[model samples]
Target: MDTVLTLAADNLLSPLILFFALGVLAALARSDLTIPEAAAKTLSLYLLFAIGFKGGVSVSGHGVDGDLVASMLAGTVLSFSLPFVAFAMLRVTTGLSVVDAAAVAGHYGSISIVTFVAATSVLESAGIASEGYLVAVAAIMEAPAILSALWIAARFSADTGNPVDARDRQGLLREILLNGSIVLLIGSFLIGYITGEDGLVEIESFVVSPFKGVLCLFLLDMGLVAGRGLRSSAKHLRPGLIGFGLLMPVVGAGAGLLGASLVGLSVGGTLLLMTLSASASYIAVPAAMRVALPEANPSIYLTMSLGITFPFNLTVGIPLYLSVARAVGG
Candidate 1:
């Protein structure tokens, strides 16, 4: 408990979190502070490329083995299954329609790359080593939750007026598979793997030195976006909705812990897995939702994922996961 509190405190005080807080406060106060859209996009690309490249480089050194394959399988199972858990919880606890619940559930099940990156940063700061192939795990986790959500909506929801046909399914699949973030992540990972240690050493100054600074700025932009969503969508945030938003991540994390134990992940890898499961995908899932479930309320899912859960994970969930991983895996 003390270790968790100490780590949480340190994370909350870090420059990345502080900058995010600043953006949130600025947005809430209606200040004019903004990150240009292009710059924000560039920062996101750079982070994805850097993280993916490093993970590939690590894989180059570690080599493909049973552990890598096992972790990937674990991640896929978690992603495909978590939305059902979330949908059941929402049905029990909240008044969300099946479509909305499923949409929100999809976000929870999908991995948030930014959150994964943030966890990596935390692990690095704590001098912990984790499996770099987890980047590939992250990429693999993105699509299954979305498919699960669509399945749930089609299976349970009575309102099938806007039913997704075979063609629609094809398009959604294409979008998920070709998402820019996934492309850059997998592409960079392959590049790094092909180049190996020599590639990393040559580009270390560019990707490593500026990583935190870029992350801080990107998070600041995220904060701004989240704060604005919260401010505008306050009316939609009922107690039940808010409760689910806060509670679902912990539930997801528990599932992740089980997965980690089964796969025999080390403490750092366990923490990363827990973080990935706990995170809500504000980026990829939301984009997919906009296309697939247009009737589902964006304000609800977006506010819950980005405004409420994202900040909570950054401030508290990561530290708590780390402590738990240490206790269980250390």
Candidate 2:
């Protein structure tokens, strides 16, 4: 308990979190602080490329085996199935319409890259080594949740109208599979794998040294976005919905712990998996939601995922996951 508290304290005081806090405060106070859209996009690209490339390099060094395959498969299964759990919970706990619930559930099931990156930073600070192939797992986890959400919406909605009609199917598939984030992540991973250590070495200064600084800036932007969402969308965030946002991550992390144990992930690897599972997609899933469930309220899902859940995971949840993973995985 002491160790967990200490970790949480340390994380809260870190520059990345502190910058994010600054952004949130600035936004809430109606200050003029802002990151330009173009710069934010560049930072996002850099983080994705660096993370994916590093993972590929790690895979190159470690080589693929049964564990990599098993973990990816497990992650996909978790991604596909977690929405059902979330949807069921929502139905019991909130008065959300089927479409809204499924859309929100899909966000829960999908992974947040920023959260995953934060978990990696935590692990690195602790001098822990995790499997590199988890990047691939992250990529694989993105699309399946979207698919599951669509399926749930189609199957259970009081209205017979499919959220995704035949006309929209091809475009939606392309959006999911070829989303710029996914493409950059997978492409950079493959490049890193093909080029191996030599590639990393050649570009180490670019991708390695500035990674943390870039992440801090990116998170500042995130905090700004989240704060604005919360300010504008507070009326939409009811008690039941807020409670769901708080509780669901822990539930998802519990499932992740089980999956990690089954797949025999290492302590660091287990923590990453737990982090991935606990995260809600503010990026990919939200974009897909806009296309698939046009009637669903963006304010609700965005606020739930980014405004509430993201902060919780960063401040409290990461430490909890690390402690649990160490206890069980050690």
Candidate 3:
């Protein structure tokens, strides 16, 4: 109970969470605030690269463990399987079509890097240390959901269909598998691993020491994006879809908790696992969906995931997971 309260109180005051709230409030109140798409994309690249390099540096120093392998396997399984579960639930609960359902499902199955970063902040604030290889686990979780969504599209989409074409299919595959974000993230991680402390030294002032400060700037932009998405989605959102959006994270986190406990993860690691499960797709999956499932209403999935559930997680869910993981793991 003390741990829960501590986590909750600390999370409430975090800059990233506050920035996210600013976005939500601005959107809810119909503010004119916005972030340029190019700038937002650049920030995302920086974040991915910074995190990937840091993770590689940590891993290079510590070396991978058997437990890391197991966790990666678990992440892959969760990525591929969660979509089917989500698709079925969305179909039963909402009026979303099959393609839309699958697209949304893919988002849920995939991991959200922002959420992972936020969780990292939460855990670090509490002085809990996590393994670096979770970065690789995150990378593994991003792509499989695309395959699942495509499979669902082939099997169930109606004639009007998505935006995909034969020529774009190969490109889409490459994008899903080798998105610039993923490439940079993995590449930076490899560089860090190869160079270790010496390599990190060359870029330390830019990457390591200034990380949290940069995160604040990034979250400010994230706030702007979330607010816009929320404003765009306000009318399209319905009670049922919103319910699914909120409930899915809980369901995913519960599964992650069980998995994490079984794997005997550290408190920090468990929190991260819970976060990866709890996070809803907002970035990569949404872009992929915009390309592959254009018929699906962007306002519904993007808003619900980013505007609604994201705030919920940043403000409430991270602390909730930390509290729950400790109680269960203790």
Q: Rate residue 160 of model 3 by lDDT.
A: 39
> Which scores higher on lDDT, 1 or 2?
1
RMSD of 3: 2.2
**Ranking of candidates on lDDT, top first:** 1, 2, 3
List ranges where model 1 is wrong by over 4 Å.
none
Best by TM-score: 1
lDDT of 3 by residue, 178-211 (tens): 8887788889888888998888989988887777
Model 2 residue 160 CA deviation in Å: 6.3
Sort the candidates on TM-score, descending order.
1, 2, 3
Q: Which residue pairs of candidate 3 clash?
A: none
Number of the candidate with higher lDDT, 2 or 3: 2
Q: Taking the tens digit of each residue's C-alpha lDDT, what string does model 2 give over 1-330?
A: 998999999999998899889888989988889999999999999999999999999999989899999999999999999999999999999999998999999999999999999999888888999999999999999989999998898889867355567879778988888999999999999999999999999999999999999999999999999889888999999999999999999999999999999999999999999999999999999998898888777888999999999999998999999999999987
Local accuracy by lDDT, each model? 0.93, 0.93, 0.81
Please give the lDDT score at residue 129 for candidate 3: 83
Clashes of 1: 0
Candidate 1: which pairs clash? none
